[model samples]
Target: MSRILVVDDERNVLTSFQHLLGKKGHEVLTAKSGEQALSLLGSNSPDLILMDIRMAGLSGLETFRQAKAIVPKVPVIMMTAYGTTDTAIEAMKLGAFEYTLKPFDIPKLTALIERALAMGQLMRTPVTYGAADADARAQRIIGKSSKMIEVYKLIGQVAPSNVTVLIRGESGTGKELVARAIYHHSQRAERPFIAVNCAAIPETLLESELFGYEKGAFTGAVARKPGKFEQASGGTILLDEVGDMSPSTQAKVLRVLQEGTCERLGGHETIRVDVRLLAATNQDLEALIRDRRFREDLYYRLHVVTITVPSLRERKEDIPLLAEYFLKRYSRELQKSGMRLSPEALERLSAYEWPGNVRELENCIKQAMVLGQGDVLMPEHLRLGQSSAVQLRSAPESLNAVRELARQHLEQAPGSAHQHLIEQVEAQLILEALMQTQGNLAQAAKLLGITRPTLREKISKYRIQRRVHLNQREG
Candidate 1:
């Protein structure tokens, strides 16, 4: 029988849990507060913990963190009321096994407890991957946030297996990095790692890119060329933005996953390739399935193992660490050594919602490194356009100041003064939004309170040019 620890501030809750768990032929230990829970943890060494989120003394989250430090592998199931649901989610990101809402069903709670204990046992078992490979893979993913720690653990668990992996996250959440980390730690680590962006390539060329055609097979087929599948033989191939694949391409990919063979474009020869498939997407595949946009079969095939990377907003505790990492990196690259972020700047970063995730933060730091005057990065040096708009809205003086500047510009211009002022304000807002969104036109449009088509039309009329970066163009 497994041993369980139940922690709650209420006496009735402790008694009820003990009675429920004891009836199941398992040992139960009870604690009324976080202090008692921690004190019992070392001596009791329970297989699972059911703790409340809100306690009088030390909070449940703090107690969980401390408990994990003492016994990292033990599973913790947080119990929270409706008001503390968000805190429960934060606990889950911080490595909690799972969470159950207050007034949870008895059967469901018992089942959850069983699953958590089983998972704890599995985690404690030795992994097949070499320690060195695991360490190296962990180093490539740079974040100590609870969410990131969960991701690292998932990578270690899934890399040794040959199953297909689907990485789902927002556009700037480093899906590609997760794929690479998996490949680096896998059994096929010595083999090549090829990445193809499905959304970036045209539908017409996607088939040819995945399955090469023979010489003289088509207009551009002057030489026999191998596709990404053949090129990534005995290795891993990351299909970035796989949700953007066309129906025909999806059919072919499904065939490859099923039969381990694919036919080249305009050729009858069926080529067999051994490659581990990793797919990444910022889209909702289920919604696409419901809409008949993405193939259900292909989705199931690629989703043998799914890893959802947390967005920057979901893991805000790591903002300072990520900011510092980017600061040191960009500083070294830009030859501006000894640069650091100020406490106020870090606070501002933590407060802002990072819609663009880690990539946007990196860009902001790089921009600060280039444009900032002093060694220490300040709040003024960071350009959080959308977030800055919030601050400006809160303080009417800032908006008035901008309006005053526009008025002055209008007064100074002679021909088409109003038109000139409007153009200037629009252009500046467009640029700032573009910068914050890393030149993503769709996101910029959303920030500017306009539709994409309208934004594109205005960009053409204003003759606006934006430099393309990694996430600059919309899928």
Candidate 2:
């Protein structure tokens, strides 16, 4: 029997957890807030903590941070609702064992708890990834941000199994890199790794491309062509941008997933292939399912263990590391030794919302390296597109833009729009200033055209924690 701590702001949820776990013959402790959870930790060391992501005061993420400091070895499992999945992912990056959506399945929850408890013991042991073999497997993947660390952990946990994985992120977020990472770490590393971009291939040929073709199947079909599925037999096949696949193709893919067999376009023989399928897409598949653009059955077939890659903006703390990595990479490729990014360049890079994600950042660094004259890349050398330029505008222009945005939001929204819009704008401006100044309150205030005291008060009012360190002077 294990002692579990259940924390949530909802009294009913606390009661339900107590009743459920009590019947399992486990000792359960309950807390209503983060403070209460921390207080409980002083006297009782539970084997696991199950907590809600959103609470009244201290958020589950903040609470998880504190709890880890208090009891580092104890595993924490966060419970989140629909829209708060990203926050729960962030919590996972901060050392939470795992997260489950609210109204979770009882069987899944029980299985997760059992696994967490068993994994807790393994986590306590000192594990190092310094071996040359392990380093070689993960060399392409960079970023030490908590979020990326979480991704790394998940990859390590899931790569060995032949599980269907759905990698979701915006374009340029390096979903393919992640897919490759899993392939490299898996037992099938020696096998061929084939990648097919579903969107890039026309729907007319996608079926043939994936499932192969028999001789004389169509015009210009002179010979038998083994499709990607056949080519990747005993290996991994990554279906990139899979959401764009046609319904017929989706059905075929679903058939392949379900039956593990596919027939060539004109052949009657069913080809049995042992291939691991990995699907990636930037689109909201659930929304697509609602609109009937995507097949819900196929979505379920591929979403066995979903991994949502964090956008670059969401993990801004990793900007410097990524920038430096790109710098060295491009420098060596271009044969320009001793290339580096300046502090101002890094600060701008960090402050910019990378809509194109990591892919855009890499291109910007490469462009700067190509055009930049000196060894050190400066702010002027970087071109982050029109969006970034707008983001870097003078305070007055930014304020005016925010005012217009708030006006539009108010016009469209109902109920307390004015107050909400004002608070939103205020918080955004303060957060941007802090990000640009790398959490230097005085510099941020100066940039925002506000007094330090006023900025401090605003930070407190908004409960903003300056965490990005992009503006640190480059060494």
Candidate 3:
């Protein structure tokens, strides 16, 4: 459960929030004024702070600054019965999670509170490579394989430095966990660690989401908002699936790397950002660059240091260990005791190739925990279904593999060496993605790290000999 601190000068506001948030399973601590909130911070580092902007004494802005100094990672959401656009913008620039006019819409307020709590938890949660600590809350990497050990070592070596890191791995290979581990062990451990799923966010809003926006920036943009970079200043920001970013977003991100500044959409003023940027991707960036999809400069900037996580198939020896860890974790979470994986179940888990990697294993275990009865979880409980296991796509080719192919292509046609390399690699990558997705254009596009139109254009540009139906949307 999350602990929330609600601060307001009015007694009714404090009591209402305390009672309402309490009903939602959050431990709500309320204070009458900014001074009281600051005092509360002395002893408690709440996951989220909800404060009124117009508090008596201290003031909400001052309290927010002080609260950040006290617990730098905690997220604060400011509310005011008397809110102006300037006040909201100021609060956001000061690193408030959100700013809202008071007389709260209960549902919207509750949703906002949940989001802040989730963001705060993501920032502060510990990521370990070994067994769970005494407190079961720590997320463990759950492998002793040499591959994983190397990954752990890389995380350690790179965590202390301020270099931008590129984590390469298949989807669900625990890249986010690696990013979190780096953050937790780094010098900026006390500061926030914001994780943005670049692939999940739509291309249109990705820029505004990263650099925020000015009021009247768009039709619906009623007020100015500060972006995650601002909120994570002096901290770290992990851009998950950074490969899927659009060219415009990529250019903006490159600017942030070259110069520590970004301008919000429809705004003239440049905002300086101080963040340790970490990017993770499953895409073959070399191929993306070849296809002219991913920016070459941005790729170079991100790949200053690279950590490649082993896919589950590559580290099959860790299957039993990971399965057991998940069993215990889900047992505790689901409140089911004496739940053990059967010998047959262990054999089954070990035999099957995990296409989705660690995340799929965790989900499989959690599902089994809910399905299996008595003490032992049987093989049948696993239901290691045919669909995922049957579609055994090859791992993404390494940059070295691409370079080797480039050498062969250059030897063949020195006059158009680069073009030959791009054609061969892009065509091959597109074919593989199409075959993997059974010729579904959308999925192929996603797998190829480009848009559907771009993918269609490449299909024609390469004049791929293998014809596939383009109309099918689902793969």
Candidate 4:
């Protein structure tokens, strides 16, 4: 059952909704005025809010403004005896889910309530990141690598400010988690966090989606609608895959960034917004600027602060901790809490380079939990890329893995594959050479056909240790 808040001045109106919605299996919270509703909101996490436009102490509009700051993601339906006006339109433009005239049809209102409840649930499930957040419904970004620590530091430094943050990383590297982490820590933590994927929505509709539209703006534009930027006023809006945004939308977004004001599509009124912008992308924006596909002005605006998340392969040392966390988390989720990760399974996870990063590992764990029968999650259940030990055992498999990695690099970051692959192979070769020579730099350089000075420089560049030992885990 979901929770619903019904706020009104009339005792009869509140009583009616409490009885009517309670029968529909809702935990109804009744408030006699907007002030009481705001108080209830502070103490409760209601899925849907039904409030009157006119009330004592504070008008519904004023109450809504404050309520949004408190629970921006929750859907609110405003009831008013007064018909459509600029005031009502202003309320909708400011992110009220719907404005319904009083004495609304019971069936239609119930349907609206259900829809609002679902929409709220979809967006309001807070993303738990750090260890201190204990929301059971949330997920944590588990990693303690030096690179991840740097990311945490960046989030802490920039989250408190309103500067636009550009989160750069490969797909599935948990960029959104970093964004949410920043949101959770920011001053606007109580406000909404709206994420819009520029790549997911079509270019034609992207503008209207981000900036809303007025009725009759285009074909089938039946009524006025507020865009995400307007809905996210006084909150945060994350533009994921923003590199894919069209030039027109980029200009409009640039305007918002520059002036904090935007005109809705097909509407002339300028809507001043207060939103913290966070853009995440896997694509190379600098190259896009060079190619003239992306605007340099907008790029600079977003680049005021950038947090680059390292790829999984770049931080392989964290794989054990990440994999173990996922294993335990998914076990609980899949209702197979008895299952555990085997030592060999963890080895396979660590030895393999994850192309899809944390998201792929999560899926691997969930699938293994759902499919594996015994107490242990094994290698066969993994169906993974070549792990270090396995690849070394088979030349063909090693070649295949190498080819796949190279292909991925070339596809993901064009023009970097040559140096990337060279360094990757060179690092591995250096590790093996050092192991063969017992970490003697001279002997290792001779075995690898490289000069001692060059090998030493490469080791330093790669942050590799001069001495090697087999007392601990894999190299």
Local accuracy of candidate 2 as per-residue lDDT tens digits, 110-161 = 8888777764543333222213233321345667777788888888888899
Top lDDT model: 3
lDDT of 4 by residue, 47-106 (tens): 889888877889889998899888877888888774544455578767887667667789
Q: Is candidate 1 or candidate 4 better by lDDT?
A: 4
| Candidate closer to the true structure by lDDT (higher is better), 2 or 4 | 4
Candidate 1 Cα RMSD after full superposition onto the native fold (Å): 26.5
In angstroms, give how far residue 204 of model 2 lies from its true place: 0.1
TM-score of each: 0.54, 0.54, 0.78, 0.67
Deviation (Å) of 295 in candidate 1: 1.0
For model 3, residues 139-206, the per-residue Cα lDDT tens digits are 78888899988998898899999999999999889999999999998999987788899999999999
Model 1: lDDT of residue 93: 45
Question: What global local distance difference test value does model 1 have?
Answer: 0.78
The ten-residue window of minimal lDDT in model 3 covers: 386-395
Higher-TM-score candidate of 1 and 3: 3
Model 1 per-residue lDDT tens digits across residues 1-475: 6789899999999899888877665789999999999999778788888999999999999998898777766878889886786677567545576678888789789788877876555434332222323431133456677777788888988999889999999878889878877876688765546678999999988998888666677896654556778766777789999999999999999998999999888789888888899999999999999999999989899998899999999989888878876776555446678999899999999998877788778777876775577789999988885332345655789889988987787678867877787888898777776776667775566556555666776776666774434244652
